[model samples]
Target: MKELAGQTALVTGGTAGIGLESARLLARHGATVIITGRSQQRGEAAVAELGAGVRFVAADLADLESVQALVRHCGDQVDIVVNNAASFPGALTVEQDVTSFESTFDTNVRGAYFLVAALAPAMLRRGHGSIVNVTSMVAFKGVPGASSYSASKAALESLTRSWAAEFGPHGVRVNSVAPGPTATAGVTAEWGDVNDELGRALPLGRTAQAAEIAEAVLFLASPRSSFVTGSTLHADGGGVAA
Candidate 1:
């Protein structure tokens, strides 16, 4: 049987980038994948691209009500939840405002926080589940223009450990995947030709692809990682190592 033959998964911010790829992989493994995004057009497009049996739900993580609505809409008993929704507003500490910090935390930390709260109990009832949070390498390293983004991700990493501890005894696992400079549309738009410049600086001499980061998320969300919990997988092409 396929590893996720009878499972259901919720992947937030899944219309593009790593979230989209992760949802694609999960669905390919026979999981019923439900993806959430803020854009109706993009969500529908992603569902179509992922083929049959995959669903799309509109959600904006910055709104607590939307997050709650998403949970209620997804019904009961999701075997996997990927907290891949996040906002990245880059600003130096001196220039960062309350709005920046709150917005980032609202989406990255608060949304993921309440999501685990909402879905974990049902998972506990089933005595098995997996939660994978997509964080960033800046959470572990200092990035000049991304203070708020980094802090928000750091909070998520901290929650990964806390949730793992709280949910482990109940047979549910919580973990995180931190991606380094990855080749995605968003990144390419922000940092033009970053692969060659940043790639040379990294230990592995290259940036990562969105699919590679998705693979890391897949591992944590699968039974293959049954014994793993409270861990953070760095899919940075050795950026963290360097």
Candidate 2:
């Protein structure tokens, strides 16, 4: 789909896991891709792995300063933006205080929410663009032990809705791709051995590959989904339904 041949994209948390896979697909489909990650070496390695037509930016989603830096850099050239980067501080582990809750929200919500606020106007000026904010099935179903994570992602979905409503008139579409139990490095780190059990519980009886979910994002970002503003494409194998 060279439909995006002349376009530019910025994917956050794109050094590994789902972000890397998505970047590959977008670049292959003819979009010049720029991915972000905290690790300089990993970010470079990922760009290298994608071989060509892909670039890298350094940004830590947990740091507002880094987020600003990322936004400024990407503002230089971009038509599409994928807020695919996120962090989970474990489920239900409350700090029982404003500071702790804020710590968690800072990355999952504040960082991403404001990043787009800072960058989307540039898209608006371009007169056309698509923004895909990645959420999770956990945001819909109250996944056990993921209370905080779920709530944060829910906030992201909320941002998607409000932003789309506010910006759609400018020809900027905002949508989301909510993936479930994907095989990514972060999932491996967090879900561990229990991931296999979770997969068995899915209606499809298996977890989806990163590429499968990435493809969904590609569709939403492409003109094919021009009418898809403010909507969420759930690629969870019916996990939320079941």
Candidate 3:
């Protein structure tokens, strides 16, 4: 039997990249996966690629109303919630504008916080669930030209600990996966062929594939990780270690 048979998962920002990969993995494990994105077109395409047992919900995490609507639309309890939606606009502290900072936090931290708040009660009632927040290595090592993004992810790391403590007694687990430089379309578009640079800088000597990061998420979300909670798994090719 499939490990995740009869389970249901919600993956935010699942239109592409790591989110899409994670959602696909969960579906493969026999979970009914609900993927959310801001773009209906991209969400539809992702749904098509993800095949059966997968659906798309359009949502903009930056807006609280939209997040609430998404939660309401889900209705049923979610066995796994991947808070993977995030905004990554890099800017040095000196160059940072209010809009950029607010938008990043609104999407990355605030949205995730409320999402867990909205779904965790249902999980507690159901007596078993997992919440995986997609953080970043910058939360630990920091990064130039990414002050707001780093800060937002750092905030998420903090929440992982807090939520784990608050929800563990109820049989719900909250954890985080922090990826280093990943070879996603968005990353390549922004950094431009950074494989060699990351290969030299990271201990593993190569940036991660999106599926590699998704594997970490699946581990944390699975019964195999029943004893794990409140931990941030670094899928960062040893970026933080070095």
- Alpha-carbon TM-score of each model against the true structure: 0.96, 0.94, 0.97
Query: What digit string (tens of lDDT, one per residue) describes model 1 on residues 21-91?
Result: 99999999999999999999999999889998799999999999999999999878599999999888666
Question: Which model is ahead, 2 or 3, in terms of TM-score?
Answer: 3
Model 1 misplacement above 4 A: 191-196
User: What value of lDDT does candidate 1 attain over all alpha carbons?
Assistant: 0.91
Query: What lDDT does candidate 2 reach at residue 235?
Result: 93
TM-score of 2: 0.94
lDDT of 3: 0.91
Q: What's the ranking of the predictions by lDDT, best on top?
A: 3, 1, 2
Task: Tell me the whole-model lDDT of each prediction, alpha carbons only.
Answer: 0.91, 0.86, 0.91
lDDT of residue 184 for candidate 2: 74
> Tens-digit lDDT track for model 2 on 1-242?
38889999999889987889889989998999999988999988998899889989888877889888888777657788898888765545553355656776887788888888888888888779999998998899866667777888999999999999999989999998998888777887977766666777899998778989999999999999988899989899998789
Error of 2 at 76 (Å): 4.4
Q: After superposition, how far is residue 139 of candidate 3 from its true place, in Å?
A: 0.4
Q: In model 3, which runs have C-alpha deviations exceeding 4 angstroms?
A: 193-196
Q: Model 3 misses residue 26 by how many Å? A: 0.4
